[model samples]
Target: MPTSPTTVLIVGSGPTGLTLAIELARRAVDVRIIDKTPGFPRSSRAKGPNPRSLEVLEDLGVVGEVLAASSAPLPMRKYRNGVPIADAAPFADARPTPDAPYDRPRMIAQWRLEEILRARLAEYGVRVELGSELVGLAEGRTSVTAALAGGGEIEARYVAGCDGGHSAVRKLLGVPFEGKTDETQMMVCGDVEAEGPDRGFWHQWFDEDGAVMLCPIPGTRSGWWFQAGPETDASGAPVPPSLDSFRRLFAKHTRLPGSGLSDATLLSTYRVNERLAERYRVGRVFLAGDAAHVHSIAGGLGMNTGIQDAYNLGWKLARVASGRADPALLDTYEEERLPIAADALDLSAERLRATMEAIRKPGGGLDSAVSERTNGLGGGYRRSSLATGGGTGRLRAGDRAPDAPCRDLATGTPRRLFEAFAGPHFTLLGFGPGTAQALREAAGAHDGELRAYGVDVGGPHGLADDGGHARTAYGIGPDEDLLVLVRPDNHVALIIPPGDLGAVGAYLNGAALERA
Candidate 1:
């Protein structure tokens, strides 16, 4: 421990924990992340990051590595009675637009994604403390004291529980995890080296009894993800997942030779659990990711939801820890995320039922589970109290701020709106010429905390929108002179006229006690 207290103490080193650690570390917040595991596990629990998560990764400067290491979503080749019957590409029609650069999700191992995040965290001189498990927690009026498993204690200004669904922090706070676990719907999942399936398509074999899916793992020559309904014993107890058990299941379902599958690793039995924490925070301790909520894996929203949770809480924690914002601002975390979690649970449940029904039909695949809602672009904090001020055009307060192609006026270099929104500062976009004064005032008032860019204003910090993509993406008319204030997480916080510049200051003031 250092002479000064840690700013944030993050428990667990999964995607959620790693994400929060990076967020706080990039802001120069003294953050300490710990995981109970003795060493990092190469578990590919979640398939990959969704489109919205790609945006978050882009901000964290790791999307390039992820893209380089990942493969696009593959088409599913469905087989009936061990014979290939149908091939369906779920995201074949998906294409990137100026507003949304990533149209489809990539297929990368979860462990690999965590490795990338951990490497990025190291760049900030922060590393995950392995085998450091949190056993006890006591919150003071201003700080939290965490008890580690090995007879050591750490004091942090704030504590974030990024541990999985079985979060010790959430349990220590006595928060009720209210949900049901569907034991009847259990699947054995693992990573294996298989010889039968080609790496071109996600192969699925269906029969009257059940189905087994094998998806080729990106960045691996012979690796495949094995998933299927759990095998049962005579007494109806699920046989624990093992390499031999996985081979038996594969042979039973796919009619492939048992010797074709070997080197099975990261085996686990997954029971469909849909649970949400009763509360996200108690005093200075907060829960995020699976610590706050867990959902069905049908829509692949479980990990993405957790990542977004860390994204939402990271800046608020940093601000409050630095005294840049009032402690009350932290309450908005639960207010906005709880509803989103509830919605995700319902959506996943619905998708699970629909997918199960679709699987019963011949040549039916998981393609029935794909929809616009699963893309991760439509989620926003529209009802959040932070979303104030009236909307302009088709865009509204609390909507995700869309990106567009633009150019840096000063250097004549090409740039995108995402580049402007990157980093740990608020972004204020002035749509037209009338917003020049507003942009100047905002920049002058909040120098380091905010970045104000004028689109077509022909002034300092003006962006040259030669293609008019900026205006079209933001839904602003050619002559429209509205200002859109974006939060650190890239959500539109406010949309107001240039003359109502006072509202911007008022909103910021109301959210925090004072500007540091």
Candidate 2:
């Protein structure tokens, strides 16, 4: 039987799926999310959100709660022969700046992050339909019909497969998940209680025989993430991950007593894999997160990249699915995100190799590979179809729109550019008082779809860049008249020249987002 149609049918209820659901739900789009499992996964698989993902969370209004429930990345404490050898903080150099608020990656479990996103979606009167697995997909030019494993089928204007690397949707679509998996390198991981290692640092024990790492899981005093190589029996067969196996690995590598381990759960074996889908979009159906790409967990990017994939695709989907923009707007999702996924795959592979090499030494835990690149702040969509403008300024169209502390000229209260850019509307910021007339005119013209703010040196309305923080962060000068049109996803969509009202109208009208 055919169910009622939805604007978007999102398969898989992981971080990417949850984030996409919230993004569409908050926009009032008819989005439905589903998962194959009957219950939520309790495994604290992915460690945390990276800096860029945190920025996205802030926009989605969940960053505060996430930070409240999370902790900072722990410093790695390397030990040799049960003796502390060295200590290093890989994220020490990451500091918040005016342009970027989330400088450091925040450590929260992936399952918890998904729960938070689900709550946010619930705020919009939406909930994930768990156990409603997609068993088949029939893609058409304008819509898709997804067959569920249960009984019925759901038809939607568009379908997004936010499912993981082993995505059934991808397989049915015949999308080649192209990459290599290193069978030689396998990691046995589990959630266990360890009383021996201090929770302040991520403890790593190394000996000529092997190595084992135990990192404290935030929000729990007794829980720690244990990872080690596979243990072989007398027959040289790999031992399965169990409480006994984890205890044995810890006792063999570290001087910690076997009694230190208890309540071992969420145990699984991991193989080093690097894979990316041949494409992100196929007709009206699309892929995001692990469905599009999967890589090593070295840089802790598996979840972060997936969250960003949803972030980039969310607004585009919302707009297109709502008829706010042309269907061509949907194409940019792959154009902008595919390259980043490829880059992240390579970076994760590189980081994994670097850490592996570093592990062969005495004072090597997280070495040069753990740099600012892993924070995921520098990525931008300069070459995307939705982005334009170049030549000058500190930033360009397609760059991540910067946030700045400013003053609201109306009430004389402090405000943030990010606060203004928090919703699902285009943000137009006009620099200096000279552009007030044009900004006010544009705001009146495009009242709801595009919000216009006057960032002035001394204007009576809109935002004021006190001490020039806004100007510096936006890379605008006091004299140079500029207008930046930031997309709902916080990417600069178009950089209009001074008083280019025609360009604004033309772009908005062409994109079919010209409301009010």
Candidate 3:
């Protein structure tokens, strides 16, 4: 055991914790991350990363590695007695446009994704401190002292609980994790090598008795993920998961031969539960990922939501610890993320119920109605303190700022609007003439914190006119010449329609811009 001091200490080295570590470290914030597990697990639990998650990964500079290790969207097929009943490719129908690069989700194992994140964190000269369990915590006005299992201690200005379900940190804080545990919907999941199916697609078989699903594991020969509704024994206890038990269940449901499936690994039975912490923050201790929320595995939002939570909190924590922003900014972590978690809980529970109800019917198709809300691109904080001005037509405060190909003017080189928005600063995209001076003046006032770009009106270097794609993307109308201020998270904070430079300044400095 080793004692240490850090500005921010992250508990649990899962995706969320690792992400926060990388984000804070990128800003030169001293961060320490620890996990109870000695090493990364080799399980194929989470399906893959969503589009919005891809954006976050891109921000961390590891999107390329994740994409390279993942498989593209394959058609999901629902079957009856080994025959295809219904099939659909959600992403194929909703093809990705330039505006949204990852319109579809990728299929990759959770362990592989964690590996990529760990690698990225290594680039920052920080690695996960394994075998370090957080047993207790004490917080003061200025710092938090975390008690370790091996009698060591860490003093951190802030502590984040990225620990998964049944988080020790959450328990030590005495936060009520209120939710229901559905005992009836028990599921057995595992990674296995099987010969029964050559579907080359994710297959789900549902009938009167139960359901069995199989999805291919990317980059593994004859490897697949098996999930089946649980079967109770004579005493009504869930039959423990095993290769033999899985084969027997598959045989009973799909009439598939038991001999075809073999080499079972990482088998575990999970009960569907929906729970959320009463509060995200308790003094200097905070919660993220599964520590804050847990829900049904319907839309595969579990890991993605956690990653996004860390993304939302990382920069703010960095800003506050670095003395750039006041501690009041920390409150926004709960204000913005808690609502999203609540919504996710409702959505995941609904999706699980809908799927179960659909299975009860004779010819019910898969309920693809699971809200794409967790698609990363759709989540925003328009209600935060930073948002200003409400316009009916375009330029709303709560929209995802659009990206476009624009010239640097001085450099005469083609660059995307997102490229300019890449750094950790507030970006002002002005799309009208006679405002260059205003943009320059705002940039000068904020110095390095604010950057303004002036786009010529009715010029080729400006927005494309095809349906005002760029304007609509930025939430500004074709006729409206506006200055759109984008937050560091790529969300629109304020939209000034031509005549409100003073209002933008007020929004930035005043309470109009919340800490989150």
- lDDT leader: 1
Best by TM-score: 1
Put the candidates in lDDT order, highest first. 1, 2, 3
lDDT tens per residue, model 2, 115-177: 888899999999989889889999777778999986789999889998898998899899999
TM-score to true structure, per model: 0.97, 0.96, 0.92
User: What is the per-residue lDDT of model 3 for residues 257-343, given as tens digits with 9 covering 90 to 100?
Assistant: 877898999999899889999999988889999999999888888999999998889878887888877778788889889988998
- Residue 169, candidate 2: C-alpha displacement in angstroms: 0.8
Query: Per-residue lDDT for 1-516 in model 1, tens only?
Result: 423378899999988889889999999999999898999999898999999999999999999999999999999999998889999999988899999999999899999999999999999999998988889998888788898887888899889998999999999999999999998888999999988577899998878887789999999999999998888899988899998888888889877798899999988988999999999989898999998998888889988888899999999988877887778889989988889899989999999998888889998888887788987899888878888777866788878899999999989999999999999999999988899999999999989989999999977687999999989988889988989999899999888899999888877666422321
To one decimal, what is the Cα RMSD in angstroms of model 2 from the true structure? Answer: 2.4
Residue ranges of candidate 2 with Cα displaced over 4 Å: 367-369, 457-461, 511-516
For candidate 1, give the lDDT of residue 326: 79
Task: Give the winner by TM-score: 1 or 2.
Answer: 1
By TM-score, the candidates rank as: 1, 2, 3
Steric clash pairs (candidate 3): 385-512, 385-513, 385-514, 386-513, 386-514, 395-475
Provide the clashing-pair count of each candidate structure.
0, 0, 6
lDDT of each: 0.89, 0.85, 0.79
User: Least lDDT summed over 10 consecutive residues: which range in candidate 1?
Assistant: 507-516
Candidate 3 local distance difference test against the native: 0.79
Candidate 3: where are CA atoms >4 Å away? 362-371, 390-392, 407-414, 457-468, 497-499, 513-516
